[model samples]
Target chain A: MQKTTSSISNNISFTRGVPALEALPTTLFSECLQAVLAGPDGKTVLQYGHNGGYVPLKQLLAEQYHVDVDQVLIGNGSLHLQDMLTAQLVQTGDVVFTEQPSYDRAIKTFRRRGAKVIGIPLALDGVDITALEEALARYTPRFMYIVPDFQNPAGVTTSREKRQALAQLAEKHGFYLVEDVPYRTLRYSGKTLPLLRELNPERTITVSSYSKLISPGIRVGYLIGPRDIVKPLIALAEDTTLAPVLPTQAAVLEFHKRGYFERNLESLKQLYAPRLQAMISAIKTYLPGIDFAEPEGGFFVSITLPQESNYQHLLQRAKEQGLLLTDGNGFFADHLNAQANQAHTGDRFVRLPFCALTPQEIEAGMQRLAELVRA
Target chain B: MQKTTSSISNNISFTRGVPALEALPTTLFSECLQAVLAGPDGKTVLQYGHNGGYVPLKQLLAEQYHVDVDQVLIGNGSLHLQDMLTAQLVQTGDVVFTEQPSYDRAIKTFRRRGAKVIGIPLALDGVDITALEEALARYTPRFMYIVPDFQNPAGVTTSREKRQALAQLAEKHGFYLVEDVPYRTLRYSGKTLPLLRELNPERTITVSSYSKLISPGIRVGYLIGPRDIVKPLIALAEDTTLAPVLPTQAAVLEFHKRGYFERNLESLKQLYAPRLQAMISAIKTYLPGIDFAEPEGGFFVSITLPQESNYQHLLQRAKEQGLLLTDGNGFFADHLNAQANQAHTGDRFVRLPFCALTPQEIEAGMQRLAELVRA
Candidate 1:
């Protein structure tokens, strides 16, 4: 269906920005569904589901992170948790620090709540921590939001020192820290690090989801934080969705307990690693002018291209050649920049999601992009 | 794996609310997941899912409604849509009317948005229209929240005439009508009537779910309204769970396509219809003074117990007998009665959910409830 839009439509692209539902665990999902059906129908879906998520999934995550289960509070999604976090803590005009070019949705969320956003440059090693420390000193932000592992668009993980330092900073200041690790489990690299929650659970809200690892369609993700804080979040959740669907959670629990989660992640990583490498290698060869970081893990890679306007034009060109890319303008917190007012030069860059494509597709898409840039 | 809680004794019941994830539909879920896997991972989850929901499921719903695809805006659940709707339309102290004792979560949602809730008397025929019309004439209500067919708490549906009159009133009054019908299809009766949307799609926000009919854990629901209203709702959807999970949608779509949906519903009616009757009969026979509406269909029948707070105190006794129930305190717009310095004592009622039990279990549970009321 053709959906009409208002001013906000300029901020998002459903037809172009959204990738097809990819690499979901249909076999395991179906297997879980069958198991649930084979049992009894009455108690599974109609009765209330878990306050947290399905048990085995929670336990699996707990074991994965080597933490107590009390720290996790599964919700409808990371955003659902984010909505709660902002609602409880963020007063109107309260400054919430973040990367200058982070997930636009989070920016929108805070802005919608009337929070003043403090944007720090997205460095090769996460957000500008110096700016954050200073903001913590001066603005005393309600909290700082970061996708520490394989951050969206930027694809940069913070250094261990930065993680430790941020934790220290949070402990000194009374502000809560919300670390979203939706992409953490989708690691392409062989190495891993301790989560922010591992360092300090008291002040941190750590949220992740099965959507990336399993499927997003189930609308599953969770957050963990202090009980006093989580109470409001849960109360907020109660108001918003009452609870997550019982049937899907049951299916997800089985999927995890049945050992579908780990096996599927390994297969997913195996499939994605080369595609990431292919995009990185292709960027080095073809799009030499842009500066970006290729994440060691996760689905995104960010690039800083020379500023230009009309990303839609570039997007249209790429689409004509059977390739797709999201306009960089779509990801910014602020749409209008007096400095960004130059036509054809206002739009600086766009995100190319190589993870959604094959090595072949990535190569072809990049080639088409290369041609478009040259043209 | 032990979760620490304030409510936690040394004895752990971590398993209490946890869903039996293995109970959901894995076979169909697996099919959707299989497509997401072996395909593009990024596009599957990372790329935008539809604002309303998965297109196929929406199409299936459209077919069920015999309406065009444009009418539906799928949400995380009826509750999530409630939050978004309030965010868009409600401001502080705005008047909102609902059934006196209705769905607690919906009440909580509007109250959280700072709406001045005016609850009308509830009944088997639906909400008291005389009180509703008086409130409509007296104050400026942004919307009315209704559960027409086999509603929550009071298990009631609007007559066809009332539905039409409500729509006509909304048209005359210039207030939006937020109709939550998650339980519409879950009727115990063979016949149901026309919906508020049939009379006025432009002014109505129709909420329905697969939670009751298919599964709750899947956390899938939809909002059908005008494009002008729904488009912004979709943008709001983007910042929420992004989209419902692909696996669940895939499974649900397949279920709809394969004609399993109608079969499931038919079988459910046969299985639970007797249970509903048995429970209703027992309540009528055993409990002398309890006032309640005998639901035609759905999971619950609402009972308004005689003049006393004894029913509220009966919760603990019921739990001692291994039975649990939510009190009427939950189903109000304001959980607290500002008029009385105590939690609202509209405590003379409670919702009785009967779908989860066999007829024998229904009879047994009712007998126990009867004993509590008598004592």
Candidate 2:
């Protein structure tokens, strides 16, 4: 595969899921890191940590998420935790389930493990429950991977009823439910629902990261699940990287201890809300015929062009005009698995991320993209 | 499996492979981090980096190692890179090779990938070349993992002739040579040998880490191989952790740029050489009958106890006296492969790290360990 980039002099990239670069808490992070280096736990912060994680960070995450300390596994990032979970539980050719047009990188990870990934079509509220039940009954998948909170590429959240049903379905079918909730805390316009792990404590593994809330450069994330499920993952973690970066974990703990995490998260919400609104307003003004859902939170807004409009062509043309967006074909499986029929819905769609761009840039980029679509 | 600890009140641990806590360049690290956060690359440092690594950091490493930039792949740590390489190359039930008493964690990573690991006996210079040739002739192993530079748990650096022979054997046998050189830069008294990757660039993959040279808490390491071998590993790195912690990579670059890494290495050698001598002297003064090859450098000095002595008992007794050392059984494979007979060689050995402790503590700990051995 060829590497693709869309930069001409100074491009406006709507393709990154990173937080705003200008608003990153660099000063605060440096202060906290210096404090951690000078603090009583300086030696522990600079040495090789326990295989599971930094204990105090785990304890703090446990309290924040209402789980016992033993249930948490800190890793290099949430993606690392997902790969570890896959390595521990998945055998070659095992069946795995995921939402149609799910996170592209995650689907790649599952497929890399030799899993036959089957995509369940998504409904308005979430993945289609009936389709999920049918797949669970017919395939006996090793697990169902779901992005429950502001699903990637689609920007759709699962309803409370569907979440409950997903838990019950996994229990009934003797399978595990893997919930990825990196955007769970970024709710700008909706009420928060109980986590899938909370609903199905026995059979659910929840993975989340501080990248979206804090900074991606630190690369600290966690997995919370039953003790039995977590034990092997800890061993896998030991074999994977020995341990997560100790100083990063310590810095995160210090950030939380100093009450900067909660306050910075609030500031992040304030910073992004206007950008999201600007993107939505621009879409309405510039592209009247395009179809999209107004995202309540999270970085992405999925746009579907008319059936005859080629998204690949539009993406290339838009790149020429300094507008960078992701073609939705990347978010779907390659039809190498059981759900071959469900892989093609992404042909006319594109994913636009608003978090990394300012309001003015988002408006200009969206207008340029509209011009490309019209041409 | 039960957890093991080497601690008591006033304990001195010779079990840790970490650097001395009191001597870590914390002030330098903090200064470098602050400079990175305040420099022109501050925003980039706090954002998501490229999948292989940060580009500038990769370029620097390539220049230092005399390899093309595309041949370098950085990960969370050296172990992480090893795991990624294993994932890219080995299939379930594939044959792999390692030294008889290898780094235990690396053995675990190989086995976790479902490779049947065979242990080759070690001679005074390094792994036995004749035995390696025999194993290569008998089995088409996927790769041979060797710690040629100050081999962990044994403290024996491979001879230059053996290194050249091993590289040729890999090419002749059509298998890859996986060289782990975490301690290559910490030479106190030995002449530096050419890296295996340099001798056999087409068939050798070299892995190394900055944990030993810098600090483990930063968790930065890299791999150098042919572009074809490294391309899939870069993809695996993407699927494994998205990227290594960006801030750590940037901080590492800044540290190198400021010339702290080379100066710090000289300082570390000065700090460790005397302690290694202290351990050797203490062993000779306290225990007369024990057999060991005096190490030129590196953290460990391995001792072989009498055949009739129960090492487990000695470990327990040593613990009671507030002395901590690693039992050699932890470094051997559990005889699940073709080299079952070679696994038991570790039964009569123990490893004592002289880097993390002071001369005074090393002397006292050795005295207590000698007492346990006699008892």
Best by lDDT: 2
Off by over 4 Å in 2: A1-10, A289-291, A308-314, A334-344, B1-9, B308-314, B320-322, B334-344
TM-score of chain B of 2: 0.93
Q: Model 2 over residues A200-302: C-alpha lDDT tens digits? A: 8899999999889888888989999999989888987876788678888888999988999888989988988888899888888877766666778888777
**DockQ, each predicted model:** 0.31, 0.70
Model 1 Cα shift for residue B106 (angstroms): 1.4
Candidate 1, residue B7: CA error in Å?
31
Q: What is the TM-score of chain B alone in each candidate?
A: 0.85, 0.93
TM, every model = 0.83, 0.92
Tens-place lDDT digits, model 1, residues B338-357: 22523224565656776655
Give me the candidate number with maximum DockQ.
2
**Backbone clashes per model, in order?**
56, 0
- Cα misplacement distance, residue A153 of candidate 1 (Å): 1.1
lDDT of 1 by residue, A1-375 (tens): 111122121222212322224565555675676666455642544345545655555676667666556555677667767877788788788888776677777877888777887665667776667767766767787887878888876678877878887788888887777888988877887567777777777778887776677766566677777777766666666656777665566677778778887898888888788978988987777677676777888877766555442244776776665555666665565444314533212155556566666666666555556666763
